[model samples]
Target chain A: MPSIECREIYFSYRRSDPVLKGVSLSASPGEMLGIVGPNGAGKSTLIRIMAGLLKPQNGSVLLEGLMLHGLASDDRARRIAYVPQDYHLVFPFTVMDVVLSGRYAHGALKIFETREDRVIAGRVLKWTGLENLADRKFEDLSGGERQRAVLAAALAQEPELMLLDEPTSSLDVNHADNLMALLDRLCSDQGLTVIMAVHDLSLASAWCNRLGFLDQGRMNALGEPARVLSFDRLKSVYGDSVKRLDLDGRIVIAPRGKRNTNA
Target chain B: MLDMDKTRRKLVLACILGGLWLLACGLSGLLIGSTSIDIVRALNGSGPDAQILLVARLPRVLLAALTGGALASAGVGFQALLRNPLATPFTLGVSSGASLGAASAILLGLDTALLGSAAVPLFALAGAGLAVAVVYMLARRRGSLLSTNTLLLAGVCLAFFFGAVMLFLHYLADFGNSYRMIRWLMGSLDITDIMVPLKVFVLTIIGFILLYSNSRRLNVMSAGEEVAQSRGIDVDKVQRRIYFSGSLLTASVVAATGPIGFVGLVVPHVVRMFTGPDHRVLLPASFFAGAGFLILCDLLARVLIAPTEIPVGVITAILGGPFLVWLLRRQVEN
Candidate 1:
């Protein structure tokens, strides 16, 4: 009942240059979908639409066959949790306080947390490996730690769908792997539907169940990673500079890897 | 769980100091007049100068304290809601708008016996409300308030524009009316209208209590509007309440004693310095401190020229200007 489906989506920040053009996709509960594309492929725009943060100019987004926009903001917040690409802050709220704010959509009359609310927030913090940093100020945390804290905060909402926009864009290798593994486990163990736009092809291919390749605000391919990340599709979507390498059962597409081939 | 011990300690401190300040104001109001009276004899209600004591001095002191308290508390509310250190009753243009309304009433020759009594304050409240409405309409984006910079700039510009209108009205009024208007703008304590102080005092106390209870929410809101909204606060509703209460408080104070300056801006920051940013402690402290500061300023205004009173606004501005410079330097150094 909490499935998300988009039909004929179209959006643009400016009238002449549409960011998303007639894009349609569906994601059921408990599935992890990875979206990959070159820059300006409308990946971020699509995530925002799915998160209910942005409205599509033409077409509709439905959560379990119900129109998403018609629902109350609190109700939408309850069902869909969004972690944006950039979250800057000036205040120094504690990590626990940040996480506790996730329960905002459940009730409006009572703003303070109950015993149950604190327990849930604590549990999510523990789950996301942020229990040790509960008392630490959010701004004091590192990039990876901040991302995990945000993830914990989003998880505290207990939403059915989680939309993470480029979660690993600012992380180191160890952090990127750890975050991907965490998401993979959360998807499988807790049946959380995750739709993330990832820049790293290897990470997406390694963890995601399905992959969608987008180019020029249109979907080039939508299927298993093997089909979506195929050499022919990659060449068409990203130009001839993109080439796939097969070495010892690992697959990698070098964005500029071919330029160094003559070296 | 309540921290009863800390609360009790704060309460005791507030009461002791506040009570002392109140008594001092009352004594000064009586003792500094053209004819001084004995405090013990006055307290016993057997003093020979009881008529002047009961009629003139006590009312002026009480009116000053009440106006000061209201303005300071409203200043605290505006600063927290807007998340700006620069926001105050005067800086946000509420006082300017009130003065404009008062000047308008005078110029229209509506300062007659039948209508002048009520028209000034009512129109002042209306002017303040209209000013807030225009600022809100201009500064809101995507149903949220704009950044503090934009809001402060808009308020300052509107205050200047409204002040110009008020000055224009000053030129059209006759010499007597113009002199009255000038004194009013300079803000002097006048117990001639005791009923105004009594009405405003009751409303101010009630408003102060209601606002003090919501200080926790304001502390949370100062971080950002998005954070507050996501924490289950109906941001728009709370903001409307803050604006309404703050505007009314400034208007009432202006109505009671013309337009006092700087106490609303200065007292809250001074309160913040000692009490931290937690509004729970800061709000009540600012209220009392504001009353105390204004009483002292009024005493200075009286004794500086003895029997020929200087405007309270002049004293506040002279003191506040130097304090503001120090605060700015401190902020920069930090």
Candidate 2:
């Protein structure tokens, strides 16, 4: 069975306007699913629904044939972990403190972290290459490092499925590539499922086994990267003023040219 | 292993220092009062000195400690839940509502003997509860308490509304009633009975436990709401639990002590500077430091003018104001 199955989900922030409409998708074990979409196409909203952060007004999310929303929050968290696109730290929490919080569900009711919890947090920090910065304050980290810290925190959950919203948004190119490669390795080696909302089509195409294109809160395309990243599909969603080229058997998209209307 | 040991050692040292400081402050609070009783005589339980120490000073000191601890604990929870460092127990209009209730009772000439001296406090508690209920209802959206901004705005507006009502009551009162109202508003720890403090002490302990139990969730929550929920926290439940417990804590303290200012606002920040942002350590440490801090402030208020006591609230503001400004400046520079 699919690890997580979202069926015909519909959500609206307000009564008159909808943010997601009849969105259905599934993620299986040992696969990486990438969601690519334009701005405000409900990528973040969809991920939030799957993680059960936001309740969809209609439809349901199922995990292993069980209702996702019906499970206790701790139970759900044990199976699936989510990483948000942006985090704003108001207090000066250390990186170790941030990572240790992920084991909260596993800890006893009184909220003290155990020695085992520390071990998991430390291991995840090393895996994310954040052990050296564990003592630094979260607010002091660079954007790329901060992103990795948040990912490490999620990793400390030891989830079977991980959902990330624009995990590479704050990372430099080298760091972004490294993160994607790490996620790719984790999925294959650990038999984990990763569903991430990505804006970079090239990275998504390279790392993800499946790509889902979203537009106007609906799934515009869903298939292999080569099939979903077609020139016609790209033009339809992103407008005709975009160009695509094949380099090293990879698809690259860019704006067609600078407008010369002034001349 | 080395780093964990060092952190553990630092925490233990802080606890030791805080415990010693609190003990010293407690002794000074007992020894130094208006009459300047001899500490040896008071401890020996001889003559009227013993009565003054056991009957008057002991209750006052305990009350101050409980109120201070409650306010500080609530403050930490409020700052975390609201995601604003500036948030305090008073940020939600609980104090203003309590004051309005007390002022109205005084202005209307309610008999103090009627309910055995608890009339004012009961009214104040009711008013605080009502104000929080209104703010909670107004801020809730789509069945979730997800909007901290909306909650903050609602709380501020309610505070203004309650403050206006209080001013109108003040305007309507006679001169003697107005004087009593102002005195109560200034916050005093002068109480003869020990029941109120004991009851509130129990309540504060419960509140502290509720907050401490959720301390780890609060750490994740400080990152953001989405982050907290992503880590298996029932965000709405946790928010509701903390908000209710924090507000109730402030309400109970305000009912007894008449809105002691700055303890709720400054103590948590001060404690955070030493304990870092881990609420597990921050909450309990704030309780101890706050208890000691207010006892010291109350001692200062009692002895500075000796015979004529300044309001403890005034002393707290005088001490906390400059410290807050300096802290804000540092925050900006950083």
Candidate 3:
């Protein structure tokens, strides 16, 4: 059974303009679904509705056949963790303290982290390769390291589902590749369902099993990567000419036709 | 486990700082007045000047400490709740609301005696509450909380409005009452006894404890509203509680001491720089540091011009304005 199902979700920030226009999608457990869209396409909004951060005006979101919108915030947090792209650490919070906050939904009144929670947070940090940086100030870390810390915090929730919005936007090429690979492992090894809104169509093609293309607050298409990553659909949705090439068993999307040589 | 150790260490250090502050301020407050009463003789309650020292200087020092601590702690909560580093009690219209309340009461012939002291504080509290409610309402419209920048702008505008109202009242007041209103506007620690400010002090302690008890919640809140909500925190409820409680503390103190400046803004940031962002540490540290900081400032206010005591606000502005500028330069340099 799918871990999440959204039915005709409609959302709008302003009354006249809709952000998500009846967008509906579903993801099975352990599946990595990548939502690829251009700017202002409501990719993040759809993810937020799925993660129960924002309520849909007309549609319902269900987790395991249970309506997610009706559940309490802690219940949703216990089952899923959402990591947004921009994480600005305004204070001198330690890496461990920030990660330990992931366990907050489990124990609300426990101000100090329990030993068990600490062990879990530490394990997750180690998995995310941030164990050595546990004591360092979060703001003091490099951009890639900070993104890893964010991943560690999300992983510490022990969630069956993870939602990420542009997890690689702030990272360099190597860091982005490493992070996507790590997420892929988590999905396969732990049967964790992952849904991420990504801008880089190439990364999505490489890492995601399934793809959902959003355009103008609507899901234009949803299917396997090969089926959704076709040249025609890619060009239509993104308006940038994407060249799909088969390099052995892997598929890569290159900007073949859109490059302007006159510059 | 390490966090616990750090929390304990912070508590101990804050306590030490507070104790040293109180002791130094107490002695200075008692000894630096017109007569230069001896601290040892005052404490022993044996000198011919003992009654004057115990009754006058003792209450003044305690009031100054309490008012300072209250305003500073309120500052910390305001900053956290608003998620703006520039937030403070005075800037948020809390002091203006309180001052308006106090000034209104005084205009109605309540200033000649202590007959309406409790009433003045109550009205001041109400004024603060109303101003906060207005700010909250303005920041939150049509069901969503407003952004931090908008909230700050609204608070400043409301503060200015209240200040204008207060000025209008000042102009309409009689000659004798006008002089009293002008003095009160300058801010004084001239309460005859410790009871009124002591009540405010107790409220400050209670309010600060409530704020500190939820320090962990505050830590998560500092991340962002969506993150805090996604983490199971009732962000709206917590924000409302913080706003109400912080405003209560701010209004009460402003009423008690006629709006002393800069302690709330300066103390919290200084405390955060040294103690880090954990509210458990920040709250208590701000409390003690604020109390100590204000008392020391008050001591300067009295002795800087021995024969004619400058308003405590003047002392704080002179000290705090320069210190803040230096801090800003340091932040930029770092």
Per-candidate clash tally: 0, 0, 0
Candidate that beats the other on DockQ, 1 or 3, i.e. the better one: 3
TM-score, predicted candidate 3 vs. hidden true structure: 0.94
Task: Report the C-alpha lDDT of model 1 over A1-263, residue by residue, as the tens digit.
Answer: 64788888999884578888888888878888998999989999899888776678898999989898777667787888877777654334567767766766665444244667677888998888998898787888999999998888788888888888999999998999899888888888888899999989888887788888888898877878877899888777777776687766666766675457675
* Residue ranges of candidate 2 with Cα displaced over 4 Å: A259-263, B1-12, B111-116, B327-334
- Every candidate's fraction of true contacts kept comes to 0.12, 0.71, 0.56
For residues B108-219, write the lDDT of model 3, one tens digit per residue.
Answer: 8765554445666676777888888888788875666555666788889998999899889989988877776677777888766768766877788777777776788888
Candidate 3 residue A14 C-alpha distance from true site, Å: 2.1
- The candidates, ranked best first by DockQ, are 3, 2, 1
What candidate 3 gets wrong by more than 4 Å, as runs, is: A257-263, B39-47, B113-119, B144-147, B331-334
**lDDT of prediction 3:** 0.83
Candidate 1's TM-score: 0.80
Predicted candidate 2 versus true structure: per-residue lDDT over A144-214, tens digit per residue: 89888988988899999899999998887799999999898899999889999999888888889999999
> What are the DockQ scores of the candidates, in order?
0.20, 0.66, 0.66
- TM-scores of all candidate predictions against the true structure: 0.80, 0.94, 0.94
lDDT values for all models: 0.76, 0.86, 0.83
